[model samples]
Target: MNAEARNARWNVLGLLPAQLIMLATLIVPVGIIVLVSFSTRGPYGGFDYVFTTAPYRQILFNEGWTGELEFNPQYLIVVARTMILAAATTFICLLLSFPVAYFISLQKATAKMLLIYLVTLPFWVSMIVRVYSWIIILGNDGVIAKTLHALGLVDNMGSLLFTDTAMLIGLVYSYIPLMILPIFASIEKLDPALVEASHDLYGSRLTTLRRVILPLCRPGMMAGSILVFVPCLGAVLEPILLGGGKTMMMGNLIQLQFGAARNWPLGAAISIVLMAAVLVFLVWRGLRAIRRERAEAAA
Candidate 1:
């Protein structure tokens, strides 16, 4: 065989061990979850081999267990609200991150590094700590309220804790880094010459940004959206801690079933449904990306 063919064979062979380890660790556990989601729960809250659609039906109709997960009107409203929150959070993160990334891309190397470091500084602390800290910062007697009161900006204390706004703040704070990184990566690779060329061709800044910059950054935006949205869909910590446990997300619901309710199969089913939703979104993005790449190639 030629050298290139031999090298390709060796590369494939080299990847086999790591791939096998991943399959054993992740793929196997996911397969088990899928199976359990479709099966019945035992009396004591374990998987029973008896196959049933009751779990899925419960989720749809909000019936099984306490009948909440079923598709009743109240449950439907909650589910819809959850989806809306996820969508809103994703859209907002993208809108904010894009401009920050654009600004950073234009900065000198030292300033850019400092800005990027600031964006990621939160990661130096634990996520739980960050979420919990918001309570102190936004509570009735929290930092903002106290500071305002001290400065005579307000006559009375204002309660900001345990609200949807607080929840959103936590979500945005936690995931901003996740949104920024991919966009920065996409922007960093952009050719400065192209922007200059667009300007020379008499394109206004707005026109150049909309037409030239955004199109090239589409892939990055898509990737960053996925990074932010998928985790936000299942966000458990920020909501529970900052939203004062009033917020009920799929992640929280799934955890409740397995922990307090002692219903493994139902919990597994909810988890599977959540995973499926995320998978569908990812698949849609992947297909769109593939189509874009193909169209670009053809053109």
Candidate 2:
């Protein structure tokens, strides 16, 4: 019908700006990055406009070709370290978020709003400031180390700053709220009657939580997890600052390639690998979520 066609056209028109913005900001930028990752740079440190597989090769074999450039297990170990750090940060954030979210969910009218506001208030600060704040707090002269020294836990302040532990702390501090928000959103939307019914069936709190609440919360859990893990995986800033700017993570290595090492090709290659890793996680999470939804429907 003409009317149907007109309505469809209008609907699409309404979506046009959003689609354009998505393309401009997300799709276009990502496409350019991917394209650049496949190409090489000129000696002047700019794109050479020459396309080649040198970058991809560099990713796999970063020995004399790149840096301490011999095919080395050390590079792989650095990548593994980044992975472990990301995984640990995600896990800890997830674990902490649930309890905080549950506490918020148990609150009443004004209290719930206040608690949520308080929880999210920290997000108002710039991420850079938030990250750098940890540097001051965890440094040798920082409060915790100084306190520990005062308590005679050690004669000197702990070398707490610029270490793996500091990196983890910064990561967790940065992302805990992200994990918390989604879980809190899910918890907020949960039906109290369902929980009541579970309790009515003589289910223990633990059993009800394990069987009912956690399953219902999977979508949010998955969402929170993806948010945390994706950014955490390719993290550079925290590791660079708190991890002492060592060969700590892929992010750090990629920075080294493009900047200090003057090897744009190698940097781009590593970026592509990290992007692929992100895509894999996203796809896996999507599949899991779809299965969860189907299972819930069947139930």
Candidate 3:
């Protein structure tokens, strides 16, 4: 073969490992889930090999005692709660992270490195441990309650645990570092000249931030949001631990199906649905990003 063709062949060979890994990891598992989602539940636990659409059908409808399918909004409620919590967590992280990241980015090189290390120090501990710590802090008779009692703020020590507020606190604490790191990276790479130009043009502080800094940091903000939001959707620990099993999220529902519910088909179906929704969001974001890039190029 000629040199060009030989080099092209080697390049294709170089990509084989990555292709095989994706096939083994992503594609194969998804293919199995899709297959299972279309199958029927077994007589006992597990799934039957029989082909049926009952799993997906049951997502929105339930077979009644009289053998009639009735519309059910239970799972939809869980989905809505999951989305709201994830969105709220992402927004809160973004709000809290921007100032911290900007401050870190503005520090001297040594101080910046030290601050980054401090921000990431929490990651060294296990997530379960960190979550458990929040439980202690939010639980009745925990630190907050004790402090309140000492200050005579209230007659009784109040607890915030096992509530949506507690979940938000845990989620924000756990994911804020993720948001901060990405935004810090983006801000670090920003050109100071852009801010200087904005100020020179008689821009107010807010105007400079809105017109210059924010636009530059958009990519980082997007990345951080995706990182925080996606995991928050499937967060089993925070909801279970902080919400105290009173609040049900999509992850909890999926776990129930696979474990106690013993409805693999339904679980797989839910998994597929969640996966599809996330895939749609990611694709839309990617397309929008591509369009923006193209528009910028044209301009």
Candidate 4:
């Protein structure tokens, strides 16, 4: 056999193990969830073998005794709320990450490494522990509440915990590192000559950022957005802990179905829906990236 053909065969053989692992771990579990989504609920809260569309219908409508379909907004509201929370978190992270990334990118080598380490330092701790720390900081008798009271901003130690603001704070804190790393990577690779040229042309700093830096950083921003948004949509811990279970996100709803509600089929259906939505978003982003690359090449 030719050397090229032998090399190709070896490459495929090298990838075979990873392909099998992915199939076993990801594909199999997702396939099981999809199958369960179309199943019927048994008398005792488990799934039955019978196939049915009732779980999907439950997400969209209320069925009358006589089988009339009435539009229901309960699950719809949850989905919308999830989307809004995810989108807002992604946007906030994007805004916050850029400046930090830019600063890091401009730093000397030692300082840059130190700054990058600091940015990722939070990951060394367990996520649950990190979230719990916010509870102490935002609690009624915590630093924020005491400071507010001391400043006469409040009559008492008003807690920031268990509010939407608290939830958002946790989400942003948890995901900001994910956002920053990608942006920093992009900015690090950016040609300094481009910035120098823009300045030589007498472009203002803001103008340069808007016209040059942002365009070059688009891929990183998109990557960071996807990383933040998708996971935020399915986040249960932050909403539950910070929002005090008062807020109902899609993840919380799914957890409820599987745990308290004891409806496996419904939970599986919700999981499927969430996965499909994420898949659609990924496809859209991927297509946009491809188009942008094509445009850049043509230019």
Measured by TM-score, the strongest candidate is: 3
> Could you tell me how far off, in angstroms, the CA of residue 158 lies in candidate 4 after the best superposition?
2.9
Please say which candidate is ahead in lDDT: 1 or 4.
4
Query: Against the true structure, candidate 3 has what lDDT?
Result: 0.93
Q: Would you list the clashing residue pairs of candidate 3? A: none
The Cα error of candidate 1 at residue 10, in Å, is 1.7
Candidate 4 lDDT tens digits, 1-299: 99999999999999999999999999999999988899998766889879899999899988766888888888989999999988999999999999999999888999999999999999999999999999999998888888888999988756789999899999999999999999999998899899999999999999999999999998888889989999999999999999898969999999999887989999999999999999998998889879988998999
Candidate 2 clashing pairs?
A: 63-69, 63-70, 64-69, 64-70
Model 2 CA RMSD to the hidden true structure, in angstroms: 2.6
Error of 2 at 245 (Å): 1.9
Question: Can you tell me which runs of candidate 4 are displaced by over 4 Å?
Answer: 64-69, 151-157
Residue 162 miss distance in model 3 (angstroms)? 0.8
Looking at candidate 3, what is the lDDT of residue 188?
91
Q: By how many angstroms RMSD does model 3 differ from the true structure?
A: 1.5
- CA lDDT, every model vs. true structure: 0.84, 0.84, 0.93, 0.93
Model 2 CA lDDT for position 263: 76
Could you estimate the TM-score for every candidate?
0.91, 0.90, 0.95, 0.95
Can you tell me which runs of candidate 1 are displaced by over 4 Å? 62-76
